[model samples]
Target: MTSKIAVLGAGSWGSVLASVLDENGHDVRLWSYNKEQVDLFNSTHTNPHYIKDHTFSKTLVAYNDLAEAIDGAEYILFVVPTQVTRSVAKQVAEILEKNNQKVDLIHASKGIEEGTYMRLSEVLAEEIKPANRNSISVISGPSHAEDAIRKDITLVTVASRNLGDAERVQHLFMNSYFRVYTSDDVIGVEIGAALKNIIAIGAGALNGLGYKDNAKAALMTRGLAEISRLGTSFGANPLTFIGLSGVGDIIVTGTSTNSRNWRAGNELGQGKSLDEVIDNMGMVIEGIATTKAAYELSKKRGVDMPITSAIYHVLYDNADIKETINQLMTREGRSELS
Candidate 1:
């Protein structure tokens, strides 16, 4: 039986995933807060906001109302920006209460919020009822929306407290071009997704600085270690950091031009101020916020994350890239072990 899938965000990733599910023969309701996006998807069969080039199928229905989008849906996909995730989940919880419907939640967003530093699923669990917590799953990995929309082969991980719930979503989203693996470590997956963006921004800075592959390689390896340190500090399995969501995701986001974090870093590398880069890009770069949150989390948990700290200082404290590099290189050394 086909599942009724509802995607909450209309950005590139959301639209791309909705398109994949539609092609796989599921009934997908793609929701958006904007009226123009709804009209384009429903009328012209194209998403002018994100994936403007791809043609959406008739199975993809665009909804402007949250209740209508969630009504009778078997599964909900949360794809909103990290900053708005909590608010949107609260709104969804209210609608579910009003309509008396219960469904599984699949989150694909990555980034920690400013104040809470909570992962996306944590924010959802807090906003929703206790009973709804069991149905939440996180879908994350190296999947980039730009390539996915073009039907390029991509791999990602689906994680949840319940393996069955994660596998259910794995089957729902897997297509000819997209593959999904399962992980019991949702916390690790979320950490990997959130932290990789900051590293990507750092990578972009290196690229902007005209550094070669040697610099990128060192940054990627050292950054992965720091991300794993933070994840382990939070009780996530350390091994999950080596899986698809960790090193795999870090490499994709840090290297790809399609990554918003990497692009933001690139602009910063080119000597543009943070405000200038944000204004020019005109999209939410998850790294900027995640850097700040991860920095705080690392300090609170006593985890050693020199790379994240450097990126944080560079972006937030107005520290120079050259000086940040010197600081990281001069940090106290420690033994490497599990």
Candidate 2:
């Protein structure tokens, strides 16, 4: 069946994913908050600000009006920054109620809400009225729009509490170049997605500090251990950490030059201030907020996430990177098998 998909937040990932869906023969309507961006996408079929020089699918449409975007769409995919997800959800809820529409919700954003510390799906549940909503699914992994645009072999997971919904998204997005896997472990997928960015910041800092490959490897390895510890505390399957949504995401976000979180961390390691990094990136770095939430959650849950705490202090408290690294290394030595 030719399904109608509405994609909210026409950023790099959102735009690219819309194009991918359209390429897979679905009718896609992309929504942008900025009227100028919507007009540009409609006129030129390109989002120069984010995915420059890449042309969009000919059948894909862009809209500035939320109502138009959601009109008759079967699935609504949100790729907005995590911080603004609630506001967007409220707006979507209003539109859905007014139009008497019930649609499946899918979010590709990765972050924990700063104050509430809620995952993206949780935020959606809180804001979107149940009667107007259907199944909720999250699509996350190591997939980057830059690489996906080039038709690279990308693997990601579609997770939901509802297995049928996960399978639906999996089938919708799956293709030769982009493979999709389904899982019922939404918490694991989300935690892995949110927390990996924090580790990537540490990894990027290591690179910025002129550390070698061994240091990066150690950071990635220990990073996963801490992520697994914290995720399991939240009722997530421990094995999910080793899956595409967990380790796969950390490796890509931690290592890729295409990763905004990594680039932000690299800048921090090279001596850029948080304000300076935010001003320069011109995009929301999910790790900054996720780091704060993860640190707070670790403390609340009594989970030992030393690396996450260190990154939180560096970003929030202006802790010295070298000093933090020394403190971590000089801490009472423990067995790696622990």
Candidate 3:
């Protein structure tokens, strides 16, 4: 039941997951590109830069060198931002090649690559050699680090093409507070994980504009339609959208202040420039980049995603938020199921 796990990325979510594994009696090695962060976590057993007022498990170790962190690990978890996923995966592949070790891959990060429009799993698959990889799995849902660290009842789905691989991850992170479900719909899970951030941005913008629950409710409902539209177009199960990674993720990220994508949208709706919001947040607002990727992807796939398009224009074209909302409101009516 005990395994050596290398968690690459020392951000808020990564640290929290590493702590969870450590508490589960696993040997967890957390790697951060920033040596200071690794040193800080090792010395104080905390990551104040991201998650404050919380102490990490003492058994969890921090490493600056990727090779050292994954030296003997059986599972490698990628929790870095989407933009850096490919680069980090390349490094991981090289290390795995030199060691001639193959490990199951699990990524908690979500986003579609802007130019390639590939899902994070796809990006990892491309970078990590097939010989050095066992199975690629993704853990996604409504769970957030802020809530998970408090031992809240958090639920997520671990999905992969291989059912056995998913079950393996399910047992790895499941606990009293953290519940994990298994799914074979890797495409649906990853799409839902990546696209929900776009809807969350719209939800935050509505809140910033002083919209009521009725309006927020409408936005979320229609946003689900857009997510499902594109997801199913790419061969995802429609039922997957109603599950944890889809509607569950939307409700949590879209309505809550804890989501960086929502917070970024709130600032944007309040008349702050995208640059200002991004600079102030000092974190990766995935929806901003994801909006662009999804927009292009929807166009290429001939899928209608007005919400994603509106957010893309606002973030990239500097469109007026209020006007954009009005435009969305005035769009021609269609059947609810359409």
Candidate 4:
């Protein structure tokens, strides 16, 4: 039952997932784009930048070469940023073509490409060669890398066009602390995973502005509504939004201080500039780019995503946050169901 798995991206999430797979008795090869990171992991079994407190599983291996990490592996799990997924996929495709290898592709990143507005799975499908496509799946939910490293109980949904593919991934990662649920609704799962980050920013912003629990509660509720609307407009199952990838994700990201998007939004609400927030974060704040993509996609699809639009204005156009909140509050009242 053990499989050779190549885990790309060496970030906190990637390292933690590789660790989890190793714990599950898999042969894991962790890959990083940076040579120094690979060296650090190989020498000390620790990633000071991302997971400084914990050492990696002794059975897990690290590699700087993508081809070396992917060679002879049966699965390739992508944990890189969404914006760079296409490029990494292209490289993986080239390597697969060269070696005549095919493997299942899984991605955990959550974000939509800015201009193309393609979901992470879509980006993989477009970039990866068809011959190398075994099946593509996305594993996502409210899970964060920090808690995941601590073996905190986490539940995530795995989605694919093929039911068997989803089940295969479920068996691979399911454990006492880590649980996996299967769904065929890739559109809903990915949409929920991507859009919730934007709303989390708004939630954090509200908190930073000294808004009470009432305001945060209202923002999260309305945020879910708009998320459902946009997701359904894209042919996603409305019910899927009620699942882990949807409301479950919103609850965690929107409320937790560990969320990068929420943290960035909080800083912005405290009167810091977006650039300052991002620079201070030092990690990719996915919501910043995803907000623009969601806003543009909502308009193109004729879906009313007022919260997304408002966040987009604040982040991209330097719109005043207080004025933006007032404008949102003043919008003509509608039925709660609407």
Estimate, for each residue in 1-338, the C-alpha lDDT of model 3 and write its tens digit: 89999999999889999989999999999999999888888999989978979988778899999999999889999999999999999999999999999999999998998899999999999999899989999999998889999999999999999999999999999899999999999999999999999999999998888888998888888999999999999899999999999999999999898899999888887888999999999888988889999999999999999989999999999899899989998999988887
At residue 179, what lDDT does model 4 achieve? 97
- Encode model 4's per-residue lDDT on 1-338: one tens digit a residue: 99999999999889999999999999999999999989989988999788768987778889999999999999999999988998999999999999999999999999999899999999999988779979999998878888988989999999998989999999999899999999999999999999999999999999899998999999998999999999998889999999999999999999998898899989999999988998899889988899999999999999998999999999989999999999999999899997
Among residues 3 or more apart in sequence or in different chains, the pairs in candidate 3 whose N, CA or C atoms overlap within 3 Å are none
Clashing pairs in 4: none
State the weakest 10-residue window (summed lDDT) of model 2: 51-60
Off by more than 4 A, model 3: none
Task: List TM-score per model, in order.
Answer: 0.97, 0.98, 0.99, 0.98
Cα lDDT tens digits, model 2, 209-303, are 99989999999999999989988888999999999999999999999988999999999999999999999999889899899999999998899
Candidate 1 wrong stretches, greater than 4 Å: 132-134, 336-338
Q: What is the lDDT of candidate 4?
A: 0.92
Q: How accurate is candidate 2 locally (lDDT)?
A: 0.93
lDDT of 1 by residue, 197-241 (tens): 999999999999899899998999989999888898888999999
Q: What RMSD does each model have against the real structure?
A: 1.4, 0.9, 0.7, 0.9
Residue ranges of candidate 4 with Cα displaced over 4 Å: none
Q: Tell me the TM-score of model 2.
A: 0.98
Residue 119 CA displacement from its true place in model 3, Å:
0.7
How many collisions per candidate? Answer: 0, 0, 0, 0
Model 3, position 337: C-alpha lDDT score:
80
